[model samples]
Target: MRTDHMLSMIDDFNGAGFEQVDLMAPIQFDVSVRYLKEDPWERVRQISRRLPNSKVRALIRSRNLAAFDFLPHDVIDAWVDRLVANGVKVIGAFDGLNDIDNISRALVRAKEHGVETFGAVSFCESPVHTDELFVAKAQELIEKADVDAIMLKDAGGLLTPDRIRTLVPALKSVMGDRVLEVHTHSLTGLAPLVCLEAVELGADAIHLSVAPLSSGNGQPSTQSVVRDLRALGYVVNVDDERVDAISNRIREIAEEEGKPLGEPVEYNGLHYMHQTPGGMLSNFKSQLETAGLSDRYDELLHEVARVRKELAYPIMITPFAQFVGTQAVMNVMAGERYKVVPNEIKKYVLGYYGTLLAEIEPELREKIIANGASDIRLEPSEPAPMLPSLQERYPDEDLDTWLLRAQFAGSQVDEMKKTVAEGGNADEIPQPYFGLIKALYEKSEDGQQHLKFGDLAISLDKSK
Candidate 1:
C-alpha cells in the first residue's frame, strides 16, 4: 500500500445494524503501509478489528514496491507476528518476487504464522482477460502452495465480462470455497455488472471502493456492487446511512487536499469500472494533462509489450509507463536511455524502432490478433495462472522456506518507521502514481497529520 493509503471510510459502520447484512466473513480492504509495521495500534490499524473482525481483507502494495525484490524473511516474519497478534487472519500481497517458488514459500510462512496467504501476478503473457489459466494457478496455490484462499487481481483493469462468465465457474470447480475473492476493474464499464455475473457464476467476494473516489481507473465500485448484490439476493451488509456519512467525511477530506473529483459523475452501470482507488484523492487523467499523448497511451502500451517480447525475460511494464505511457515504450526499445515527446514516442513505436516480430508477444499479442482485436482494453479481474516452476532453476529449494516482508494494502511504513528518509526517488513521483495517493491521505485530520512527514515532497513528473 502507499504511505497515504488508509482504510475504507467505514468507521461509521461500527454499530449494531451490521448484523443485518449477510455478506461472507472475508471482505476486501485498503490499508496504509504505516499501520502494518510501524504503528499497529494506530486508529487506521483498528479498521480490520471493526470489520466485524470477521471476513474482510485487502490487497497490499506500495507505490514503488513493483521495483522491490521479495521481502526480507525477517520483515515477513515480523508482519505475520503482528497480524496474528492483532487477531488478523488471511493475509495477501504481491510484488517482490524472483519466481513462483518464492511466492509459494511466502504463503507457507503465512500459514505457519497462523494466517492464510494469497498472491497475485498478471497473466503478463497475454492481455486478453480470462480465467482459463488463473483457475489452474489458483488450484495449484491451494494444494501446492498451502494457501487457504486465492484472490485474482486485474491490477491494470484489463478484463472482459465474457471472460469472467467463462472463467469464474472454472475457478470455482477447482479452488471451491478456497478461491474466495475476485479483484477486478472498470476499464471496460463492466465492473458492477461483471461482478454480479461473477458472483452468480461462483466468485465468493470482490474488491470495491464505496464511493466514486477514484472510480474510473481503479477497481469496481463497492457501494454499487453491494446494492446490486442485495437486489440479486446475495447478502451484502452495508448501512446506507452509514455509507452516506462515510462518503461525506471522505468529501471533507478531498476538499482539504485540493483534489478534483474528475468531471461530475452520472451514475450508470459502467460507473464501477471507472473507480479510482488511487483517485480517492485525484485522477490519473489530470496527471496526463501535459503528456498530450493521452490520446495515444493505450496504443503505446501495446507497443511497449511488443518490445519486451524481443527482450524475452518476463519483463514488466514499469510504473514509469503508467505516467508517460508513450515515452516508456521508446525507453524500453531504445535499449539505452533516450528522450522524446509523448506523441513522438507513440508515433515512433508504431512507425519505427521495434523488432515487430519479437515485440508482439506470441502469448499476448497472438491472442489479441486471434480475437481480431486491434486495440487493447484493460480490466482488473485476474484468476491465478496455474503454472508451476515452468523454468525452475533449482527445484530443490524448499517451496516453504524463504524470506518475505509484510506490507499490508494501503499501509505506509517508511515515515512511520524509526528512520527519517529523503531522496529524489521519493520525489518526481508519477501522478496517477503517488500524486493521487498523497492527496487522499490529506483528507481527514488523522490522515493529514499521519502523512505529515516534514519535507517529504513528491515532485510529479510534469502533469500528463
Candidate 2:
C-alpha cells in the first residue's frame, strides 16, 4: 500500500483562505485518524498513493494501542521507518497514562529514523490522580521531546468550548510550532464550538469524525462540527457523499454485533456534559427530557448557564453534569461547591473507570460494586474563617504535620485499598492505620465517607 502523505492538492478549498476561521471545517488542516476510517490496508494503500495530498493519520488510542500489553516497539520502529521512507510522516500521540511511555519512546525512535513525528497528549482528568505529576510530565515532554506537534484529544467529549479557547492558547504558548491538532468529542454539544474556538486561536489541525464510525459507543460525532464550520464558510475538504455510506456501514456493524448505536446526534439541548460521567449523563439527559425542556432547550441552556455562573463551587468537581471536558476544565470546575480532600491523589477517583481493574479481577469488582463511593463538597456560608473540621479536631496540628502522617500512612493505606478490592476487615488491617482513617473521616462530610482502603461502610469514626 502507498505510504506517502498526500499533501499537494488543496483542491476546491484553494480558492481563498479566509481571515475568520471556523474550525467546524478546518481549512487549516486535513481530516485524518485511522481509528475512524479503518479502510482495509489495500484501500488505505490506494488512498495513500492516490491522495498523497490528503494526509492520513493513525490514532494510537485504545484500538491501535491496547492496554499496557506489550506492543512491538521494534515493529513500530520498522513500520514508521518504512512509512517515512515511502514519504508518509506519522502523527501519533498518547491517550492513556498507560500508553504514554510507549508512544513517547516511539516518538524518539521515529525522529531518529528521520521521520517527522507529531505527538499529542489525549487530555483527561485521570492522571491528576498523580496530583499534577502528569501535567508536569507533559510540560517536560514539550520542553525536551522535540516532537513535531502536540494533539489534544477529547475522547469522551468532556471538554467545553470555554475550555478549548483557554487550553488551545495555553498549549500553543508551551509547544508553539509543535502544537499540531485539536480533536474533540461532539459529546459535550460543544465539540464544534470548541473547534471554532481552537481554530480561532491558530491551532494547526482540527480532527473531525468522518460520519460512519462516529457517535456510537461512547464517542461524539464530528458531523456537527463539519456542518457548523461549513455554515461559517470554512472550506473543509470532507467528501460529504461518503458520510452516509460510512455511517450506515457502522450502524450495520453495531446491529450485527448486538450493541446499541450508543450516542446519537440530538439537539435535545442538554450539554454534552451529560455523557461525561458514564451512565450519569444518559440518565440526566432523560431527566431533562422528562422535565419537558425539549422545546425550551434554549431556555434550559440559559438557566444552566446562569446556574453555572451563580452556583457556589466545591474544591473538586462533585459527580455533576456541568463539569464536563478534559483536565483543563478543572480550574473552573473546582470553583463549584466540592471540597477537595487533603489527600488529592488518594481521594479523587470518582470518574475512574475501574472497569479493567474490575474485569480480569473479580475480587476487585466485588469490592467496588459493594463499598459504594464518596462525593465532593464545598464551603459554608458561615461568617468566620472557620478552620476545617480536621484543623479543629487537633488544634495546633499543622496541615503539614497532618500531611506528614498521611505520608507515613500512605504505604499502609495500600492495605485499605486491598480490603476494598479483596475484602479485609478493619481489625485484620494494622491498628495505627485505622487511627488515621478514623481521624480523616471525623473531619470530612457525609459524602466523603468511605475510605475504601480503610473500610467502605465504616461510619465517620471508622465504625461500620
Candidate 3:
C-alpha cells in the first residue's frame, strides 16, 4: 500500500471505533523499505501520533523479529524497545515453527515495557497439530511469557467450524482471565463460520479487516462479521456508519489503483494438504508456466505435501514455505529428490532454525546433510552476539539504523535512503480537495494551478 493509504486506513479504523490495528512487520521492513524504498518506522511514528483512541499493534516474527534468521539477544531487546518508542502499544510474537522458546523472550520484553503482548500459537493442520497440542502450546506461552493475551494465529486458514468448536474451548480453559483472540485467514472459505464458532466457544476477540482487503486469504470482513454478531444478539460496540464509510473508501481506492478486491472462495480440500497461501499459489502457477511445467502443478502440490511430511511438517508459512516450495520445485525439475538440497533445507534439518515439530527421518536427514552446505555445522548452536561488532563497524549509526542494517542485505538501506532523498515516494494529498487539485495540476499545460475549497485555498507552481 502507498504510505498515504496506510495512514488513511489507520484514521478510518479509529473513526470506525476499532480499538486495535496490525502493522505487518515483515511486509513493512522487507516490502515497504527494501522494495518500495519507504521508511516504515517513520510511518509507525506518524500512525502512533494520529491514533488517539486506537492501539498500534505490531507483529514480531519470534527470535527472527522481522528477519529470517534468529537475531541475537541484544538485537531483540533493541527491537522491542524501538517498537515501544515508535508508538507500538501491542506486540504479537510468533515463530513460524510455533516454537514458544523462540518467541518467549520478545514477549517478555514487550510485557516489561508495559506494552500489551499477545503470545501467538502459529496454527496449522497436520497429524501432529491437534486440539491438545494447541492447548499445550497456549499454556506454555502463558507460563513462559506472561503475555496479556494468547492469539490462535491460523495463518494457513485451515480452521473449520468443527475444529473451532473444540479448539477454542480447549484454549480458553487454560487462559484464565487473559484474552484468547482468533486470527485466521479466509483461504479455506470457512473462516467466517470459524470466527463465529470461536466467539460462541468463549474466544474473547476476533481479528478482522474491512472489505476489499478482507476475505480471499485475508481476514473475515469487519462489516459482515459485525452485522452477523449483532444479529446473533451480541452487543457489538462500534460505529457502523463509520465502518461503512471506510469500506466505501477502501473499495474506491482499490478501483482507483486497479487492485484486485477480496472475494469469497469455494472450500478446497486440497488446500488442507499443501497449505500454501493464496498469494504464493499464484506465484507458483506463474513460475511453473515460465518453466513450461504448468501441466505438473498437481504433481508439484503433491510433492509439497510429501516434502512437508518428510521434513516433519514445518508449518507451511514463510521461510519454511519458501524452503519447501523451492526444494519441491527443484526435486520436480531435477527428476530426483534430495539430489539437490538448498542450504536452508540443510540448516532446517540440522535444527538451526529451532526444534522441529517432529524429527525428520534418519536416512533423509543424513542425505540432506551430505548434499547441503558444508559450512553449516552438523550440530546447530545458538547464534552469537553481533551488536558490538555491528556498532564497531558503523559507529555513527543509531540503534534503529543498526537494526535495519543487521536484517537487510548489502546496499538495500542505502538505496532506500537515496530514493527518499530523491522524493521517489508517493506524494501526500492529505484531503479529497487536495487530490482534486493534484489531478488538475497534472492536467495543466504548464504544471500550475490554483484552487479554493470553501475557506481553504491552494496554489501549485511546478514550473518554478
Candidate 4:
C-alpha cells in the first residue's frame, strides 16, 4: 500500500473503534523491504506513529526474524527492541512448527521491553493437532514465556464451529487469567461462525477486518460480526457509523482502483483435503501455468496431500506450506517423487526447523536424505553469533542497516539502498513487476536472465 493509503486505512481503523490495530509482520519479513525498499523499521515506525490511541500489535515468526532461517540471538533481541522502539505495544509470536522453544525467547524479549505479548497457538487440523495438544502447547507458552494472552491463530482457516466449541474451552482451561483471542481466516467460509462460537465459549476477543479487506481469505467483516454479536445480545460497543464510513471508503477505493472486493466463499471440502492457503493455492495455479502444466493442477494438489502426509502433517502453514507446495510441484512436474528436494525440505525433515509433531516415514526420510543437498548436515546446528561479524564487515552502518543487510543478500540490499537514494516510489506506489523479478532471479541458476512482459523487457545480469 502507498503511504497515504496505509495511513488513511489506519486512521479509519482507529476512528472505527477498533481497540487494537495489528500491523501484520512488516518487520519480521522481506515483503516490506522488497516492495517498499526503505528501512522497514521506518515503515513500521510510521504505521505505529499513526495509532496513538490504539494498541499497536505486530506478529513475529520467532527465530526466522527477517529471513527464512533461524537468526542469531543478538538479531532476535535487536528485532524485538526495534519493534518496541518503533511504538509497537503488543507482540504476538508464532512458529510454523508450533515449537514453543522457537518463540519463547522472542516473547520473553518483548515482555522485557515492557510490551504486552501474545503466544500464538497455531491452529490446524490433523489427528496429531488434537484439542489436548493445543491446550498443552498453550500451557507451555504460559509456563515458559508468560505471555499476556494466547492467540488461537487458525492461519489455515481449518477450524470449524464444532472444532472451536471443543478447542476454545480446552484452551481457556489452561489460559487461567490470560486473555484468549480467536484469530482465524475466512478461507473455509466458517470463520465468522467460529468467532461467534469462540466468544460464547469464553474467548476474550476475536480478530476482524473491515469490509473490502475482509471475508475472503482475510478475517471476518467487522460490520457483519458486530451486527451478529449485537443481535445475539452481546453489548458490541463500537461506533457503527464510523465502521460503515470506513467500509464505504474502502469500497470506493476498490472500485476506483478496479480491485476485487472480498466476497463470501462457499464451503469447499477440497480445502480440507489439501489445506493449502488461499494465497498459496493461487500461487500454485500460477506456478502451474508458468510451468505449462496447468492441466495437472488437481494432480499437484493431491501431491501436496501425499507429500504432507509423508512428512508428518506439518500444520500446512507457511515455511512448511511453501516447502510442501514446492516439493509437490516438483514431484508432479518431474514425474518422479523425491527425485528433487529443496534445501528447506531437507532441513525440515532433519528437524532443523523444530521437533516434528510426528515421525516422517522411514523410507521417505531415507529418500529425502539421499536426494537432498549433500552439504546439509544430518543434525541441525546452533546459529553462531552474527552481529559481531556483521558489525566488523560494515563498521559505519547503523544497526538498522546492518540488520537488513544481514537478512538479505548484499546485492539486494544495494538495490534497495539505490531505490531509496533515487527517491523511487518504493512506498508511494505498488510495483507488481518487482515480485516477478524476485521470483525469476531466484529461479536463475546462472547470474543472467531476460524477461519480457508485453512490450516492456529487461535483461538482468547478477554477474555484473
Best by TM-score: 3
Q: What RMSD does model 3 have?
A: 4.3
lDDT of 3 at 113: 90
TM-score, every prediction: 0.57, 0.44, 0.92, 0.89
Residues 1-464, candidate 2: write the lDDT tens digits.
01111112222112222111111111011111111111122233443454344354543431123221223443344444544444344546453432354466666766787655566555543323231433454565665457777767565565666666666666666665565577665554556666777787888777655444455333345566667778878877665545544455556444433456645554433443222433543544455577554454343344443333222111112222333222212222344322222222112233221111111234432332333233422211212222344367557754432322222223333343343345333333333444576567668765366445533444453343
lDDT of 1 by residue, 230-311 (tens): 8888766666787677667566555544555422223343222221133321323443345554564444444545443332
3 or 4: which has the higher TM-score? 3
Name the weakest run of 10 consecutive residues (lDDT summed) in model 1.
21-30
Q: Can you give the lDDT of residue 65 in candidate 3?
A: 59
In the range 184-289, model 3's lDDT, one tens digit per residue, is 9999899999998888888998999888789998999998899999989999888988788788888767765668999988898999999988778888899899
lDDT for model 1, on a 0 to 1 scale?
0.45
Off by over 4 Å in 3: 426-464
Give the distance in Å from residue 10's predicted Cα in candidate 2 to where it truly belongs. 17
Cα lDDT over the full model 3? 0.85
Give the winner by lDDT.
3
For every candidate, C-alpha RMSD to the true structure in Å? 12.7, 22.2, 4.3, 8.6
Ranking, TM-score, top scorer first: 3, 4, 1, 2
Model 1: residue 401 alpha-carbon error in angstroms: 23
Please report how far candidate 2 places residue 254 from its true position, in Å.
9.4
